[model samples]
Target: MCSVPLPRRALAGLALAAAAPRLTRAAAAATSLRSTEWEMRTPAGIRHRIQLGWPDALPPAGGYPAMLLLDGQTTYPMAQAVAQPPSGQEPPRDLEAALLVGLTYPEDAFDSGLGVDSRTRDYTLPGPSAPPGAGGVEAFLDFIENHLLPELASRFPLNPDRLALFGHSYGGLCALHAFFTRPALFGTTIAASPSIWWQQGVLLKEEQRFVAALPPGTSRRHLLITVGAREQRSEAELAAMEPRRRERAQSSNMVGRAAAMAERLAGLGAGAPQLEFVSFAGEDHGSVISPAMRRALRFALGR
Candidate 1:
């Protein structure tokens, strides 16, 4: 595995800050949406919060095609609004109103730096050099598979075959992690600006290995990867940064990494999943969520 150089890490942080929009107090006040949270016990004896939103009524005969959204605190409302049928459309009529589920950790989880430590532990796969406190991904997957899915299936009219998983940033990295380790877990997965650079391209290498071992005639799963037009830095910014450092940061942009991964998957012929790459113009990393959610819903619903 390639080690992430120190200069690259510094550039990544700078790029993130440069590309991220500043959230203002006024903007926070203007946004209004009430989200409900429920505590559920994972099979591992850990309790996690799941937030949900749906139309007031259900579809006539069947349950809705549900979307399991990671990082609900930030992305849930955006997804919920995007999932709603447009005006002049009937409720549960067109695409079947989707039930949005948000996954979150305990309150104290973020006391130690934006939950990065805990997330690394829970979202990464176990390996010899898997960084200390990493590889709780399997346990987290178990929680979703054994406990969360079953409970949601029982309570709602859910289309099991159409289940979709959505994640962004670190969450997106986890979604891809799950995809390589257990592709069958979800029918369709949307990973937006995933951290392929995490642990120095371990996720990308894993995808390569997964495609190599896949059997022929396997049902092609669906994966949608998206990047923003401004995701790559301007020549001016690159010029200002250290020459050696800018190249490393450029390698990690969603466009470069996602396109490479998609091409690799496509090269696998019949065994690979159906993959799509989209570039949203005039948006940056944080602002890409709204558009990505909109595109994902349309993609999942076959609309």
Candidate 2:
């Protein structure tokens, strides 16, 4: 049998900063929704926490569309709000019901920084000459596909064809890797501010491979890549920063790289994922999650 829903207080661990009052209210509102938590271990003996929330309404014939989030500790609550609006709030007319699932570690919180080590190990894919503590992404993907999905299916009705994957930063890098390596895993992938510069922009090559390998009759998919307008830094912001920080920011070029990726992928014609690139105005890395996730939900649900 599926586990019982955890009490509202159990979500205290997900608390965020004062700048995120919107998310704070959303988190509080989430307490009244139908939600549950599962503590599971991967085959590699690594423990993981899975947070799930579904609408109060019953499923449609095929079941609710499911979205799996990478940084559950921070992203899950916002997703819960997007998937199911708080009591008395009218949901977007075009928005359909969905199941929001967050993949995270135990004892994590949005502000804790405790989960960074685990995230580094799980969300990065590096080469043989790469730094230590990298390249666990393949094993992580195996766990998600071979172990986690089956367990999730046993507990709820998920529409097999409508599943999506979402991640930000390093998690976003991992999501792109998952798509290039296993295109059929999720129908939609929303990568917010992906660390495209990781391992010297290796994912650019991965993207080439994905497009090259696509068969003439490959199945349709959707990929949304979003970055904060301020992520690349304005001239004034760069000048104010220390030399090293400014240099790194200039080299990273997050906005340019993400936009370029979207443009290249868009040329994949009818068979590949339909690509959408969004740059949220005036938002930075830390603040873009909420808006990007809101857009992700609409994109995933075909709104």
Q: What count of clashes does model 1 give?
A: 1
Cα TM-score of candidate 1: 0.77
List, residue by residue over 1-303, the lDDT tens digit for candidate 1.
Answer: 111111111111111122233323333223232235677766555667788665444333445567888877777877766555433344444455667888876785532243336666666666656666666777888888777776666444565666788888777788888777776577788988787877677786778677768733234678888877777788798789896889776767666787778777767676667888888988888998888887877777654
Candidate 1 residue spans exceeding 4 A from truth: 1-35, 43-45, 57-62, 85-94, 112-117, 126-131, 215-219, 242-248
Q: Which candidate is the best by TM-score?
A: 2
Please, what is the TM-score per model?
0.77, 0.83
Candidate 2, residue 231: how far the Cα is off, in Å:
0.3
What is the number of backbone collisions in each predicted candidate, taken in the order shown? 1, 0
lDDT of 2 by residue, 1-303 (tens): 112121122222332221222233345444454677877888667888888776655567676678999989899988887677765677566778777899998874222233337787788887656566666788888898888776666555566777899999998999888878776678788999999888788887888887878833234777899999989988988999999989899888999999998888787666656778999999999899999998998899755
lDDT for 291 (candidate 2)? 96
Model 2 error, position 50 (Å): 0.5
